[model samples]
Target: MLGIQNLSLFIASGLLLNVIPGPDSLLIMARSATQGWRAGSAAALGVGAGTMMHVLAAAAGLSALLATSAAAFAIVKWVGAAYIVYVGIALLRSKPGKAAAPAALPPQPYRRIFLQGFLTNVLNPKVAIFFLAFVPQFISADAPSKPLALVVLGCVFNFNGMLWCHALAVFTAFASQRMRLKPRVTAWLSRLTGGLFIGLGLKLALSKPN
Candidate 1:
């Protein structure tokens, strides 16, 4: 079992990572601001799925391959990047006057939005790399049962990531209300969100692994 000191650090680190405005944060914010809370929540779920993938990969010795193989890393990275860009294009092309807000989408059995959110994270190889880089800080390479330690660390990270997603879903929902009445503003925000995702994907494509 993970110790208290490590648990505190794990939580703290997760909180910090969650707050950081990476692809996951931007993706969630973009969808939420553009569509409605449901859509945003859907996107949040997508991001959560992505985080879960990372945690599982880290636990299953996938992170070792991520750390060791450039080709594999690049493959996942580009694929993730392409997926983000693809999503962005779809958002940009979205029927401006159509589509309920992200909030509305979530409560009405909106499996499509949920799946969109889920796929976004699942395709991102960067999440795996991030876990490979991040989880090790607290892990002892020399510690007994390195694989088990990695798994525990991965679980902690996943939990923290979920907590962050929950917070975003709630906090952004409040702001989303103000956004809903103004259709013009909402549409513009959606466009911006789409652009953000595309930009992130482009950057990810170009980034060299550290």
Candidate 2:
């Protein structure tokens, strides 16, 4: 168990970020609504996977390396940015039509869905570097269990991320049902999401390193 203070802060941060709409959350909503639970969950898994990568990199000291080294940071940033842009384009080309619903869609291969989740997280350099930077501030710089504490912090982040995204996926699933009756809205929303992803990628690509 985390120290009371750490747990409290972790929950607070998670809840705050969870509520704020972002690319990952939006992607889950868009995919889940259109592709049903499986697809939405696939996106959710992606986010979680991305989270794991950040935590792992932080644990492995990659984040710290990137932090002090400008070239390394830029490399991560560009790679991550490009990946997001690629996903956004793929989504745009993917049919906006409701191909399946929770009830109507065939059971998605859970293993693959889970793997997709892992990959999504793994490919996101922003999340990776962000986690690298974010965790240390909360930990005591001189703590004996700094590495252990970081691992715990990463776990907290992953759990919170998954829980929040899953909740959104459920919400989006219902919303998708309602939207099936309104194809125009779905189409417009899909375009908006695609645009958002691309914009975010571009912004991230150009953003100065911390």
Candidate 3:
């Protein structure tokens, strides 16, 4: 309606993409499993908020700078990678309590969890690039306002993403509860997720601008 074309295709593609595992999904799942649905929801909301930033940046043509400027891209990439690795290390270092599974790792405040998810999503330069590359494809060249069209499409994408993210968080939490995970197992999960994060960070660090 907003001079957008192939909107159905865009929605379908966005939903599929949201299902794929990544840092965002990992964060939601980990938080849900370790803490509860509330923590996971906080993470999901944070990620959604970050997506809006990319949408705004894409509409303003700021994302183009990351696409074209090597210096800008590299600086952001390094910083993001470092942050991801740091979070991973923190998870790895978390100690499990001898008495209780819930005590394996202390519950993080919702605000902190939200901020973590937000930073993780927003700091990734690739997300900005993706918005620039992907969203514009559906915008008509002769649209009333290309920037406005981008914003509308970006909102649609983010809305669908939030649905999937929140679903993932709730489901993961439910399953973890059902399993009645032991303290040692909970600690193991934390370490495993931590290792995965470290791997992802290294991969991001070595990534070349696409």
lDDT string, candidate 2, 4-42, tens digits: 236678678867866887667766776676567667877
RMSD in angstroms, all models? 3.2, 3.5, 1.0
Q: Give the lDDT of residue 147 in candidate 1.
A: 61
Q: Write the per-residue lDDT of candidate 1 for residues 1-210, one digit (tens) a residue.
A: 432236677778788877888667766666555455666677777677767777778778786796688988788888889988997786666544534433312232446666766777777776777777777777764667656776777767766776777677667766877645455555566667778889989998997767
Assess the local accuracy of residue 43 in candidate 3 as a C-alpha lDDT between 0 and 100. 96
Candidate 1 vs 3: which has more lDDT: 3
Candidate ranking under TM-score, highest first, comes to 3, 1, 2
- Residue 17 error, candidate 3, Å: 0.6
RMSD (CA, angstroms), candidate 2: 3.5
TM-score of each: 0.83, 0.82, 0.97
lDDT of 2 at 51: 81
The lDDT, on a scale of 0 to 1, for candidate 3 is 0.91
Alpha-carbon lDDT, every model = 0.70, 0.69, 0.91
Task: Give lDDT for model 2.
Answer: 0.69
Candidate 1, residue 185: the lDDT equals 56
lDDT of 3 by residue, 1-210 (tens): 778999999999999989989889988988999899999999999999999999999999989999999999999899999988988898899887575456455789999999999998998898999999999999998899999999999999999999999999999999989998877888889889889989989998998778
Q: What is the number of residue pairs that collide in model 3?
A: 0
